[model samples]
Target: MNLTPESKVLIQGFCEFISGTHVAQMQAYGTNLVAGVNPGCGGQELHGLPVFDLVEEVIEQFGVIDTTIICVDPYDVLDAALEAIASHISQIIIITAGVPPLDMVQLLRKAEACETLVIGPNSPGIIVPGKILLGTQPSEFYTPGVVGIVSRSSTLTYEVAYELTKAGLGQSISVSIGSDAIVGSSFLQWLQILDEDETTEAIVLVGQPGGGSEEAAARYIAEAIDKPVIAYIAGRQAPPGKSWRQTGTLATVIGRDPNFGTAQSKLAALKEAEVPVAERPSQIPELLRKEIKIN
Candidate 1:
């Protein structure tokens, strides 16, 4: 929470030649990248940050790593995250996509056991504009404000943030909390965080068809959340019992298909809970203005 210009960050899979431009970009944007981890690539530097062969080596050198961003391959994501956790890294943000669900499940279990917060295996990551960049979220699409945005889709999180920023309804934090069915965290967790965040005056939830997360969020909003929750569940037109790029079909595939997470069912739950639902991303700002009297 105490994000500073010098917050210590360690890149788990920092490459020298291939990823120099990216690490430099992050450094340019005020990301305090202290070190990187790449087996057999130690004693080297990328973007001026030292590279370590393992997370333990980085820990031994740097003392304490505040946050670690996992950039390893999907198959290696679990091991990378585990290494980070072993090094007592409190917060991990996994940017690697396409990690097997079972692997994520195992990783999440381990993370939970250690009381660590893991952001994503398939996520764009979290960004608080003018403050911290935990993942790869573009800062141009973000603006610091009272609205808190949480979403499942990586692309749509940016689209919604762009819409809000354009409308002058800047966001406190915009994050893609992983779109895979068996993700580390859920809307409920972020909802609670945003609820407690004093800067957040309103909440924007961008959910997609296929997971019970939306339905669960609605239930929580109805019961606990006091802030005005503007909701948008994407993929309404997605064909049922079919795939829509890992979004819509997760419920059935994961064998946790709540009758409520389907397109129609999800929308109904939100409406039933009196959460204002937007039909499209562009409509979100208008809905926010109407609901929270913003911009």
Candidate 2:
């Protein structure tokens, strides 16, 4: 999406004036935060923005909102997003964690039907370094540059960004699609965006061992992406053949069906795709330098 510093934003829950709340950080970063939505807090002010009872009310006051940051509780996340979708909000960033996968599945369906981009149900959200803060990505680790970063884990995303920053490599955009087993978006989606992004000269893909997203991304990069890609798959030390069943019991599998969802498989796929794979976060910038000329 064409999200910019000038994008009008709304919050689905109260932007409390306290630590750990994204309001102060986003506002301080110069985000165009318009208003908020909190039922029963209508006509009241929080974090210097008018609080309304509904998404439509916020829109009525602020006109068309380009994006919304859903800060409601986990259980209320689906309803909050649906309200935003019903109000025709084009993009949503969900900050709440522990949302049931079924709820996310429901949200994804409606989001797809409405053609809305949902960032996360348990995400740190998206950040364009010096431009705008759409979610809770620690802005201190980011700087405006040519490398675009996409990852499933928030903390790892931060650590990798910090490494890039220390190596004198900065990010054009950093996206944490969420660490949940089922997230709103995928690696390919953001990879496509970064591939088309004029500002992104290279991409750093931070993935973990869980699902098939990393392998899928490797295939896409091999086929579609023109920009140089550097990959780092976490959990290489994680035990293999241990799959978490719905009953919470781990079963030892035999062969690598579905690529075993292992880091080795992801690393191998990326290598087969000719994408440079970093054994650790510190190696990322070096690998990137080898792939693309960067100052």
Candidate 3:
């Protein structure tokens, strides 16, 4: 079930007041925005797609969905995700942030039980340049190329991609798995997928001040992925002892200590794993050219 230009997508939180603006933007980017689901707003339409009150109804009326991009209220993210999972939706990109950490624990547990792939609980989503968009990433920064980007810093993802695109290093895909401690997806998960992707020759990882997934990804890259990876970790200028609060933040909130997951710690791990680290976004193109001879 590859995410391609033809994949049919459903917007779980479609509405007139909140998601209309971004829904319109997703439509403008040529994403196959096939249907939407908003409980009370069912029987209506957005961007020529029918609206349904339940995932079941959406499936019943419009066939199955390839992916569901969620932009609902923070509190409702778990329920929306559960609905998609129950419906056997393979790919889900959640763009809502600020969900309670405990809520994600339950959501992830269900996703695992159902064998579903969940992308975010606070993310910019995933984009396959010239193909499909599953979240809110600005499509202008992307174009079909060999490099695939996976990031935790939403804004930095755009910056690096724009720089790369401007340098003729257009990307094959760019995905943000959210920087929050208890996100639905992981860097390793996306890395593994990109590693197997024939379209992606190299990978660019963007890390941030929080989470230990970056460090973990470095280990996975060392032992697992065969593709050459270029990395840029943000918040290096940030004070120490700040990040990694969520390497297991929810776990901590649930009464466990997941210490040693800081920004500095993550950097050391990546360097130890031998993934080339970039100091600035502007320098990525040169680094890419150096690593892969793209120039």
lDDT of 3 by residue, 1-295 (tens): 5587677788888532235557777788778888888889888876677888898997887777889888788789889988898888988887777777888899999888887888877787888888777777888888889899999878888999999989998798899888666887788988999999988989999887655678889999999999899999876776654544423344324443344555677789988999889999998888888778675
* Model 1 lDDT tens row, 1-295: 4456677888888522126666666777788888888898899976687888988888787788878888887788889999889988888887777778889889989999998888876787788777777767777888889999998888888899999888888888887898765778789998999999888999999888765778889899999998999988888887766546756244343555445456788898899999999988899888888887775
- Pairs that clash in candidate 3: 246-249
TM-score for each model: 0.92, 0.92, 0.91
Model 2 RMSD to the real structure? Answer: 3.1
Give residue 252's lDDT in candidate 3 (0 to 100).
29
Clashing pairs in 1: none
- Cα error, residue 77 of model 1, in Å, equals 1.3
The window of 10 residues in a row where model 3 has the poorest summed lDDT is: 243-252
Kindly provide the TM-score of model 2 when superposed on the true structure, using C-alpha atoms. Answer: 0.92
- Segments of candidate 3 deviating more than 4 angstroms: 15-18, 243-259
lDDT of 3: 0.81
Lowest lDDT block of 10, candidate 1: 248-257
Local accuracy of candidate 2 as per-residue lDDT tens digits, 170-285: 89999988766467878899999999999999999998876778899999999999999999988788787653231112233566484557788888898899888888999999
